[model samples]
Target chain A: MRVCVLNGFDSEEMTVAQERKLEQELEVLNQKGDTVDYFKLRDRKIAYCLGCWDCWLKTPGECRIKDEQEDILKSFVKTDHLVFVSNVRLGFVTATLKKTMDRLIPNFLPYIRVYQNEFHHYPRYEKTPILHTRLIVDHTVERDEIDLIEDYFKRVALNFGSDLKSFKIIDGKGEEDYEFADM
Target chain B: MLICNGSPRGEMSNSATIAKWFLKDQDKVILLMKGPKHQEYLDILAAYDHIVFIYPLYVDAMPGIVKAFFERVAIADGLMAGKKVSFIIHSGFPESVHLEVLERYHRILSKKLGFVLADTIVIPGSEGFRLMPPKQNRKKQQDVMKLMDQFRIDQPFDDHLVRRLAGKRQSNKMRNFIFSLLEKTGITNLYWNSNLKRNNAYNKRFDKPYTEL
Candidate 1:
C-alpha cells in the first residue's frame, strides 16, 4: 500500500535528536515495503481556505488560491492511506494540520451525476481505507486527554469516509518508546 | 472582545479564572465554551474591537477549539480587521515552547485581517493550581494579575525572557528512558498524568481578581 505521512510539526530548529527519531520512524515504515511518502506542512506556505465556495461553484476541483496545498490534496487522492501526525497544541491538532485538513475539502467534493431518475451528487470516496495516526508527545499530554482527541479523530475520519484503523499517541519521551518505532 | 475559554472543563478552567479578572468591569465579555456554539461566536466577533483569546496549552499548542475557531474566522478574513489581539495562554508544561504555535496563528490572523497584534500574556500552570482551591491559587493568580497590569501599560512582550524561563533542560537519554518505560508498561493511556489529577482536584470558580492598571 502507498502510505503518505503528512507531518505538521514546525521544524525550523528541531534538535538533532528530534530529527533523527522522526527519520528513523519513517525509515522503518518505508522498510515495511509500503511506499511511504512524507510531507511536512511547516515546510510550505499554506494560506487558510477562503470560504468563498469558489472551488465548488466557479473552479472545479481547485481552490481559489494557487498554492502548494492543491498539489498536496491531489497527492492524497492517489495514495491508499494517509497518516497525519501533529503535535497536539492546546488540546487538539495544530493550526497547520487543521489548515491542511481544511484545504482538503475540495478533494471530497461531490461530482454530480445522474444515478437513476434524478441527478445526484456522489462523493469522491464511497469507501476508502485511510489509516490515521495522531502522535502526541507524552510529555505534552496526559492519558485522559487522549480519549477526547481520539474521538475527534474518529469523527474526522468518518467525515472523510475512511476507516480510522488506529490512533497512536506517542509520548516523545524517547526513541525507544516512540509508537512509530513499534510500527 | 471575543474571549475564548479553551479549557475542556469549560467554566471551571484556570485560564477563565484569570481572564475574568482581566475582563471584569468591561461591558462586553463573550465567553465561548469549546463546542457547537463556536460558529455563532465567530459571527458575533466581527463587531468587536479587541479580541482576547484565553486558552490552556494542550500538547504544547492551542486546543482544538481554538484551532477550529481560527479556521472558521480565517476563512472569512476581515472579520476582525483593525482589531487588537491579545492572548492569555496557560500551560502545565514549564517552557514557553508552545508560544510559537500561538505566534504562528497570530501571524496568520495579522496577514489576513491587518489587525494590530497586541502583547500576549502567558501564565505557566501552577504545580497544583488546576486542582487547588482559589485561596491556594492566590499566589499564581496574583502573578497573572501583575502580568495583566504590564499588559495594559503596553509593555513589550519579551520573547527572550519567556524562552529562557521555559527552556527544557532534559537530555535525550532521559526522554528516551521515560518513553521506554511508558512503552514497556503497555500503557496506551499515556494521557492520564499528574497534571490532570491536579486539574481535576482543584478546578473551581472564584470572583475575578486583577490589578488595576
Candidate 2:
C-alpha cells in the first residue's frame, strides 16, 4: 500500500528527537513492506486555493496553476492510505495542512451529489482511501480545540470520500500508538 | 466598522461584492483584505466600533490564510476584547447547512476574545451571485439593507431571512439525476467552458498533468 505522510510542523517547534522518532516510525512502516512518501510541508511550496473553479469545470481533474500541488494531488489519488501528521497551532491543524487541504478541489468534480443524505461534491476518482491523522498537541491545546480538529477531519473525510479510521493525540511519548493504527 | 475580506481571491472576489453592500456607509466602515499587511492593523482593530469578517468557505473550513489570521488574533488575545464581531460567510455548496459547524467555531472564537457575535449571514450557492440578473441582485441587495438597517440601530441580526438564506439541506434523488443530466447536457458547464475557451486552454481542460496515466 502507498502512504503519504504530511508533517505539518514548522521548524522551530519540531524537536530533533521527535523528528528522529517520526523517521524511525516511517522506517518501521517501510520495513513492513509499505511504500511511504513523507513530506515536510515547511520546505515545500504550496499556494492557497483562489476559489477559482478552474480545476472543476474548465479543467476537469487538474489545477491550472504550475505549482507542486499536482504531485500532491497525484499521490493523494493513487494512495490507499493518506496520513496527516500535524502539530496543533493555535487550537487547530497547522496552516500547512490546511493549505494542503484547500488545494484539493481538483480531486472533486464540480457537480454535487447526495451522499449519506447530505449534499456533497462528486468524487473524481473511482475509490476513496482510508484517512488518519496523528495530531501532536501540547498543553496549550484546549479540549474544545481538539474537538474542533476531530470535527474538521470528519468533514474532510466526508469530502474525500474516505473512511477516517482514527485520530490519535500524541505528545512526545506516544509513538507506540502508531503501531496500533492501520498503518 | 472594520471589515476584513478573507477570500483568497483577494480584492476582486465574490466576498468583495457582498462587502460592498454592507459597507454602504462610506465614512464608517474600512475594508481590509486578509494578507500580511493586515497584521500591521492589529493595533487598530480594537478601536473600531465593530469588526466584520467576510470569508468564503473552503472545504468546510476557512481558507488557510484566514485560519492563519485567526491564530494570530488568538495569540494576541484580548486585543479586541470589548469589540463586537459579525460574520458574512459564503460558499459554493448549494446548502448553507455545510457552514453550521464553522459558525459554531466563530461563536466560540468570539467568546475566547471576549467579543460579542452580533450577527451571522450565511450564503450558499454563491457561485452564481456574480452572474445574477440585475433585478434579482437588486432584491438581494435590498434584503441585505434590511439586515444592515437593523444593525444600524445597534440591534442584533435575528431575522426570518436566516432560514431562507440557508437553502435546502438536500434534494431528492430525482433532482440529483436532473442535475446530472444538466451537467451532461453542457448547460451547467457553458459558463466554465466559455472561460476556458477564452483562455485558449479548452483543449487542455481535461489534461492530467501529473499522473502516470
Candidate 3:
C-alpha cells in the first residue's frame, strides 16, 4: 500500500518517547512492505489558500503559489491511504495541518456535484484515498471533542468522495495506550 | 468591540463587504487578520469585550489564518472569560449543512477559551453577492441589514432570521435534479466559466494536474 503520513506536530510538542512510538508504528507498516511518504508539516513551507479559485478556473488543478505544498498535493492524489497525525490544540488539529487541509482544495475541481444529498466539489483525480486520523494528546480528551473531531474528518473524507477508515488517539500519560480502532 | 476579517484576500473579500454593511454606523475597528501580526491582533482582541469574526468557510471549517489565530488564543494570556464572540460564516455552497460542523466547533472553541458564544450566522450561496451585480443580492443585503439591527441592540440573533439566512440544509430529489441540470447546462458554473474565459484557460477548466501515479 502507498501510505502517506502528514505529521503536523512541532518540535516542542513531539516528545522523545512519543517519537519512538511513532517510529514503531511506521516500522510496522514498513515491515508489511507498505511504501510510506512522511511529511513533517512544521518543517515545510505551506502557504494559506488565498481563496483565489485559480486552481479550479485559471490554472486548473494547479496552485499558482510556489511552495512545498505542490509536493504534498502530488503525493496525496497518488497515495492509497492517507494518515493525518497531529497533536490536539484548541480542541482540534494544529494550524499546520489545518493549512494543509485548506490548501487541498486544489486537488478538486471547482465544479459542484450533488453527492449524498449535498453539494461537494468534484474530485480532480479518479482514485480517492482512504483516510485515517491519529491524534496525540498529553491527557484524556473529552469524548465530545473526540467525536466532533472524528465527525469533522468524516465530512472531510466525504468531500473527497472517500471514507474515514479509522480514528485513533495516542494517549501520552504513563504507558502508551493506543486507542485506535478501524471504523 | 472588534470585527476581524479572517479572509485570505484581506480587505477585498466578500466578507469585508458584509462586515462593512453590518457595521453601518457602529464605531468598531475591522482588523484584517494577516499572518504576521498575530501578537498585535491578539492584544487588541484581549482588550475588546466583544468580537465578531467574519470569514468565508475554507474546506468546511475556519480558514487557516483564522485557525492559526485560534491556536494563538489557546495559549495567550488574555481574559476571554465572560467576553462575547460571534461568527459570520459564509460559503459558496448553497447548503447550510456544510457549515454545521464548523458551528459545533465554534461552540467547543468558545468553551475552551472561556467566552460566550453569542451566535453563529451562516450564509450559504454567498457567491452570488461576489459574482453578480448588487441588485441581484439586494434581498440578501436586506436580510443582513435586519441582522445588523439585532446586533446593535445586544440581542441574540433571531431564530427566524437565522433560519431564513441559512437557506436550504438538505437537498430533495427535485432540487438535486434541477441543480444537476443546471450543472450540466453550465448555468450553475457560469461565473467560473466566465472567469476561465477571461483568463484564457476555459479550455483547460477540467485539467487534472495531479493524476494518480
Candidate 4:
C-alpha cells in the first residue's frame, strides 16, 4: 500500500526524542512493505486559500495559487492511504495541516450533491484515498479535546467520500504500541 | 471589544458582513486574520475583555487562517484567559448539522485556553449572503439582528433564540426529496453555474484532471 505522511510538526516544539521515534516508526512501516512517502509541510511554501472560486469556476479542479501544494494535491488523490501527522495545538491539528487541507478544494467539483439527506460537494476524481490522522498530544490535553478532534476528522472523511480508517494519538512514551500495521 | 474576521477574503467576506452588522455602532474595526499582523492583533486582543470571532466555515471547521490565529493565541499562553469569547460560525450549507461538531469544539476550546465561553452562533445558508439582494435576505437579517440585540457580552446566547436561529439540524426526507428535485431542475446551482459560465469553464465543469494518475 502507498502511504503519504504529511507531517505538520512545529520545528521548535518537536523534541529530539520524538523526532527519532517518528523516524523509527516510519522505518517499521517500511519494513512492513508499505511504500511510505513523507512530506514535511513546514519546509515547503504553501499559501493560504484565497477563498477565490477560481479552483471551482475558472480553473476547474485546479487552484489558481501557483505554489508547492499542487504536488501535494496530486499525491492526496493518488495515494492509497493519506496520513495526516501533526502535533495538537488549540485542541486541534496545527495550522500548517489546516492550510493544506483548505487547499484541497480542487479535489472536488464546484457542484453540490445530496448525500444522506445533507448537502455536499461532488468528488472530481473516481476514487479518493482513505484518511487517517496521527496526532501527537501533550499530557495536559483532556479526553474531550481528543474526542472533539476525532469527531471533526470523521466529518472531514465523510465529506471527502471516504472513511476515517484510524486515528492514533501518540504521547511521548509507548510510541511502539501504536504501529503503522494497524493502519 | 475585539472583533476578528477570520475569512481569507478579508473585508469583502460574508463573515465581515456579520461582524459589521453585529457591532454597527461600537468599534467597527474588524481584524482580518489572513494578514501578517498576527502579533499586532494579539497585542490588541489582549487588552479587550470581550471578543467576537466571526468566520465562514471552511471544510466543516474554522478557516485555516482562523486556526493559524488560534495557534498564536495558544503560544501567547493566558493572554486570552478569562476573556469572554463568542464565535459566529457561518457555512454555505443550509443544514446546521455540519457545523455542530465545530461548535462543540469551541466549547471545549474555551476550557482548554482558559477563556470564558460567551456563546457560539451558527448561521447556515451563508454561501452568498453578502452577494444576494437585501430584499431577499431581509428576514434572515432581521432574525440575526434580533438575536444580536438580545446578546449579553458576558453571557451565553439565549437557548431558545439560539435554537431558533439554527433552524433545522438536518432536513427531513420530504425536504431532501424536494431539494433533490430542485437540484435536478438546476435551480439550486444557479450561483455556481452562472460563475462557471462567466469563466467559460461551464463546459468543463465535471472535468476530472487527476483521473489518469
Candidate 5:
C-alpha cells in the first residue's frame, strides 16, 4: 500500500540524533509493506481557509485562493493512506498540521455537507482508509497536554471520516526504539 | 475585550460579532487578526491590562494564530502569570464540549507557562434552532459584559460562580455528536473499546518521569 507520511516537524534545526530516530521509525513503517512519502510543511507557505463557501457553491472541489493548497490536495487524492506526524506545541497539534487540514477541506466538496446545526459528509473513499498517526516529540509537551492532543486527533479523524490507527508517544527511551525502515 | 479573530473570514465571522458586543463603550480594545498587522496594532496589544481571547474552535482546539500570538507575545509568560485571561470560543457544533479542549490548553499554559486563566465563555453555533438568528455574536457580547461585572480586579477568584455557570451551559449535544460522528465516519469500530481504555490507562505503564525534550 502507498502510505504517505507527512512529517510536520520543523526539520531545519533538528539534532542529529533526533533526525536518525525519525528516519528509523519511517523505515520500520516502510518495511512493513507500505510505501512512504513525506512532506515538511514548514518549508511551504500555506494559507488558512477563507470560509468563503465558494468551494461548495461555486468552485466545486477547489479553493478560490491560489497557493500550495492545490498541490497538496492533488497529492492527497493520489495517496492511499495519509500519516501526519508532528511535534506538540502548547498541548495541541502544530500550526503546520492545523493549516494543512484547513487547506484540505476543499477536497471534501460535494462529499461533505456542513450546515449551521450539523455537518454531514459522505466517505471520501469506500475501501481505502486514511490512517493517521500523531507522533509527539516528548520534550515540548506535558502529560495532560498529550492527553488533550490525543483526544483532539481522535475527534478530528472522526470528523474527516477517517481512522486514527495509532498514536506513538515517543519519550526519550522510546526514541531509540523507533525503526523507520519498517515504515 | 481582546478579540482574537483567527478565522480567515474576518468581520462576517460569528465569533467576531459576539466580541463586538463586549467592546461597547470601551475606549480601547485589541482586535488581532492573523495576517493583517502594522506596527501600531502590535503596540496596542502590548498595552492591554487584561486579555479576552475570542476565536472559533478549529478541529476541537484553538486556531493556529491564537496559539502563535501567545508565542509571539514574548512577555506572555510574565503578562499572563497573574493577569486576567478568558476565552469566548465559537464552534459549529450545537454544544461546546470542545471547549474543554481549549481549557486544556489554558491548563498547560497556566501550569507550565505561569499564565493565569480566568473564566471562559463558550457559545455553541446557532445552526438548527427554530426561533433565533445566529445569537453567538450577540450572546458573546452580552456574556462578556456579564463577565466584566462579575469580575473583581483585586480579589481572588470565586470558583462557585464559575463552576455554576459552566455547569448550567453544559450541553449533551456535543458529546452525542462526537460519538455519532465517530460511528458515522467509519472510524468507530477500528479500535476496540479495550484499546480506548488502554490509551487512557495512565498508571499501567512504567512510571518514568516525563521529560520535556
Candidate 6:
C-alpha cells in the first residue's frame, strides 16, 4: 500500500526524543513494505489559495502558482492512504497544514455534484484514498478538542470521497506504544 | 460592532456585499480585512462589544487566514469574555449541513474563549449572487436590515429567517429532474460557460493538466 505523511509541525520545535519516536514509527511502516513518502511542510514554500477559480475554468487540475506544492499535491492525491501529523497548537492542525488544505482546491473540479444528500465539488481524479489523522498532542488538549479534530476530518473524508480510517493522538512517549495496523 | 472580513479575496469578496447590507449604519461598524498581519488584530479584539466574522468556507473549514485568527484567539492574548462574536459563513455548495459541523466547532470555540456566540448564520448558495444582477440583492439587503433590527435589541435571529436564507440543502427529485433538462439545454452551466469563454478558457475547461508520472 502507498502511504503519504504530511508533517505540519516545525522541525525546530521537535525534540530529539520525539524525532526518534517518529523515526521508529516510519521504520515500522517501512518494515511492513508499504511505499512511504513524508512531506515536512517547513521545507516547502506554499502559497494560500486565492480563490481565483483559474484551476477550475482555465488550467483545469493544476494550480497556476509555481511552488513545491505541485509535486506534493500529486503524491497526496495518488497515495492509497494519507496521514496528517501535526502538534496541537491552537486546538487543531497548524496553520501550515491549513494552508495546504486550502491549496487542495485543484483536487476537485468547479462543477458541482450531489452526493450523500449534500452538494460537493466533483473530484478531478477518479480514486479516493483512506485518511488517517495522527495528532501530536500536548497537555493543553482536552477530550473535546480531540473529538472536534476528528469530526473535522470526517468532514474532510466526506468532501474527498475518502474513508476515514482512524484518528489517534501521539504523545512524546516512545514508539513502543505505537503499532502499524495491517493495511 | 467590528466587522472582520475573513475572505481570502479580502475587500473584493461577495461577503463584503453581505456585510455592507447587513449594517444599518456603516460608520459605527469597523471593517477589518484579514491579512498576513496578525498582531494588529490582537489589540483591537477586546474593545468592541460585538465582532462579526464574514468568511467563505474552504474545504468544509475556515479559510487559512481566518483559521490563523482563530489560533490567535486560542492563544489568549486578549480577554474575549464579554464580547459577542457572530459568524456569517457562506459556501459554494447549496447545503446547510455542510456548514453545520463548523457551526458546532464555532460554538465550542465560543465557549472556550468565553465569548457569547450571537448566532452562526450559514448562507448556502451564496456564490450564486455573483452570477445574478445587482437588482437581485435588494431582498437580501432588506433581510439584513431586519436582522440588524433584531440584533440591536440583543435578540437572536428567527428560525424561519435562517431557514429561508440557508435555502434548500438537497435539490428535490422534481427540481433535480428539471435541472437535468436545464443541463441538456446548457442553461444550468450558462454562468460558468460564459465566464470561461470570456477568459478564452472554454476549450480547456475540462482539460486535465495533472497526469500520473
Can you give the TM-score per candidate against the true fold? Answer: 0.46, 0.88, 0.93, 0.94, 0.74, 0.89
Segments in model 1 whose C-alpha atoms lie over 4 Å from true places:
A11-19, A31-33, A110-122, A125-129, A176-183, B1-213
In candidate 2, position A116 carries an lDDT of 66
True contacts kept of each: 0.04, 0.45, 0.80, 0.85, 0.25, 0.51
Candidate 6 clashes between residue pairs 3 or more apart in a chain or in different chains: none
Local lDDT at A146 for model 5: 78
lDDT of 4 at A39: 82
Candidate 6 iRMS, in Å?
Answer: 2.0
lDDT of 4 by residue, A121-178 (tens): 8888887889988878778777888898899889899788888999988885635444
How far residue A58's Cα lies from its native spot in candidate 6, in Å, is 2.2
For residues A1-183, what per-residue lDDT tens digits would candidate 2 score against the true structure?
A: 788887787545554556667778888888888888788887888777777777865666778786877678888777788888888775678778888888878887665655765668777777567888888876667788788888888888887777788898887554545652365
lDDT of 1: 0.57
B113-161: candidate 2 lDDT, tens digit per residue: 7787877888887876756664666756666667766766678675776
TM-score of 4: 0.94
Q: Better model by lDDT, 3 or 5?
A: 3
Evaluated at residue A122, the lDDT of candidate 3 is 90
- TM-score pick, better of 2 and 6: 6
Which one is best on DockQ?
4
Backbone clashes, candidate 1:
22
Off by over 4 Å in 5: A14-16, A24-33, A109-128, A172-174, A179-183, B27-31, B36-42, B74-79, B126-144, B152-213
Candidate 2 — what's its lDDT? 0.74
DockQ of each candidate's interface versus the true one? 0.04, 0.49, 0.76, 0.78, 0.13, 0.56
Candidate 2 Cα misplacement greater than 4 A, ranges: A14-20, A57-60, A172-176, B27-34, B172-174, B180-186, B200-204
**TM (chain A), candidate 2:** 0.92
lDDT (10s digit) by residue, model 5, range B53-150: 76776656766656656555533445445656666666655455546677667767666546467766656653212224646335334545667555
Question: Which digits, one per residue and each the tens of the lDDT, describe model 4 over residues B1-213?
Answer: 678888998888898777656666555355565468888887888877778788888887988888888878878989889888888898988899999988998987897789988778888888877787777777667766666665544444667777777889998889889988999999988989999999899998887676676
